[model samples]
Target: MDSLSYTPRGVLTPQRSLADLTWLRVGGPADWFFQPADEDDLAAFLKALPADVAVFPMGVGSNLIVRDGGIRAVVIRLGRGFNGIEVDGETVTAGAAALDAHVARKAAQAGRDLTFLRTIPGSIGGAVKMNAGCYGSYVADHLISVRIVTRAGEVQTLPAEALNLAYRSSQLPEGAVIVSATFRAAEGEPGALEARMVDQIAKRDASQPTKERSAGSTFRNPSGASSTGRADDTHELKAWAVIDKAGMRGATLGGAQMSEKHSNFLINAGGASAHDLEQLGEEVRKKVLQTQGISLEWEIMRIGEY
Candidate 1:
């Protein structure tokens, strides 16, 4: 691999271990890890670097599983300089690096209802990238636009329509780094919003293994006719219910197990390797397919190599 020739004000490290940067805490090193000081620094570095060098922009590693073999591309991580949050009227502008929880709390405090983000563990960038939704509300329902840096070092603002957002997915331009996003939230009483968020936290804690090391939901709910036994039924089938029905709840492989508390979660139950977690997930898929005849789709993004 060619060494990166350009240097910017941001911190750059080669062969940086990625295990500590992710929620699941199991991965190999990134060939190059770049923490940009600001948008200008990021743009300049990308403009000067060889066009062949692949760039992967990552947010807080909440819903990701990087393989043990690590990533070959340059991993761009936004930090302090990109975490600002501001509110005007009912619109909230947040930097891509800001946590979804923080954004939700701030928006709620400002009497704007963005409560759907309160329980999500990812950063704003990931939330936008995934069209993250919970409790029936999604980012696609509130996002106004996003400011992004293109792969060729150009800055552009794209409206929400450009993303073609769907259930837990969005079509963002490849290699585009989201710098900031504007969301139009609804007006609400501050006290009511705060109380609602508290209730959500409590509900999540009661239902999920919140203290464990897991990548949120492991699979998406099966939709349409596939979910229902009858072709006329349109209701989605929950992933957890199917896994439970398959008798794979609390199933283990190595140190990885599907959480007993919530069958949808794939947990690193002490000393679990990335391979173990991934293998366990695949096992669940096989069991579900064999017993329920419904193929499950992954909700968590698995990257890098095995």
Candidate 2:
């Protein structure tokens, strides 16, 4: 595990603290942290990396929880070189590191509608991986294809259908790192699109705890149960409603509290640890199941050792 072996044109560090890299500010550290100079650098480094080593591709760390014990893997974070956004007629191609909001705004400026991404946090990479959506539109709806560097350092292009995207999930190959994504956007008046994004931000701020140190929604809308406790695939029952029913809306553990403003938001009220945040989320899940008989599924990606 030395830089000489890879000969990378990137910044590499061992035992790097990850707390600052995450939104919640709670993770311990990464075994090794790497910020590649560009896509070529990333592919080259990955090619030289040992097969037994693990790779964790990180976005802006918006909806993640790295455990207190830290990840024993190489954490790769894309930066400036991979954040370009290009518009061509009806298509918008965005680099993996480009912020979702930025891409949305850029598309809107080009008189295209990608307004769905304006309120979503993190980067295009994470959005594609999670199939992120908002306001009735999803990445899957407009995605044409994606470029990725596989774990073995081979670059490949995969069509949108190849991903098998569904309900906030995708079938990306294991250890592959998304480099860019192309989306075919609908035509729209630039002014109209910008106004729509403005409205979305206002709505999100009014309902969600956007001002707090939160990892967005803690759980997905229960996909199997309705509010009446019957099985329903339509996912009509929202996670917050179930949490409110369980009486855990304003629940707290250490400095972690389910935001009073939005029950589904797991927030660091102040000085919270990763353990505290995760434990509180589990507690909420337990209560919801106990009271409503509906098991909740987490939306936030939690990784590393406890």
Candidate 3:
């Protein structure tokens, strides 16, 4: 591969391994891994780089499956420079690299209600991209605006509507990188909010495979009236319940297992490869379709070559 002429006050490496970055701990290397010093550095680097080269911005890699053959794009991972969090009144402005748990804690300390983010094991950028939610509240409900670096290296602050946020998905502009987001949190007692977060954590720990090395949920709960044949209401059906009904609760493929503790979670039990995990998920999907006749859609993002 040819080296580019542009350089910035940041770290850029060739063929950085991605296994260490993701929760699943199974993927090949990225063609180039760039970590910018700041927003200016990121924009400048992007602008100088050839337009034909692909750019992929990643967060903490909570809900991702990078194939073993690796990604061919320049993988941008923000670090210390973009992890700041600030709270003013009822609004919290967080850098895209800031962890969701940290943002939730800060918001609670400031008497703001964003407890739903506490249990999400991702960064603010990933949360915004996925409209991440738990306990009935989503990022879309609180998002005010987001700052993004467009594919052409132009910076823009877009409103929440620009993404057209939906259930666990958003329409981010192709190759755009989210840098920061402003959220309007509701006011609440600091102590009460803290207590609520603690309770939520306890509940999550008790019900899910909290200690396992796994991406949170494997599949989106089936929605639409077609899945349930109920015309009046479109209540989402639980993926876990359906998987359990299909008798795939403890199914395994090599070192990958549909977590016995929580059927929906796909875990790297020990020394699992990306292929093993993905194949297991596909098998579960096939089984669910065969038994329940309901097509399951992946909630976790899978990228890169096979």
How far residue 29's Cα lies from its native spot in candidate 3, in Å, is 0.4
Overall lDDT per candidate, in order of appearance = 0.90, 0.92, 0.90
- Which candidate number has the best lDDT? 2
Worst 10 residues of 1 by lDDT: 224-233
Error of 2 at 75 (Å): 0.2
lDDT of 1 at 241: 91
lDDT of 1 by residue, 1-306 (tens): 465566789998899989999889999989899999999999888887788888999888889899999998889999999999999998999999999999999999999999999999889999998888778778888999999999988989999989887777788888989999999999999999999999999999999999999989999878733211232123457889999999999999999999999999999999988999999999999999999899999999998988
- Residue 51, model 1: lDDT of 84
User: Which portions of model 2 show Cα errors greater than 4 Å?
Assistant: 2-4, 224-235
Give the runs in model 1 whose Cα sits over 4 Å from its true position.
Answer: 1-5, 224-236
Error of 3 at 4 (Å): 2.9
Candidates in order, TM-scores: namely 0.95, 0.96, 0.96
lDDT of 3 by residue, 85-183 (tens): 999998999999999999999999999989989999999999999888877778878999999998888999999988888777788888899999999
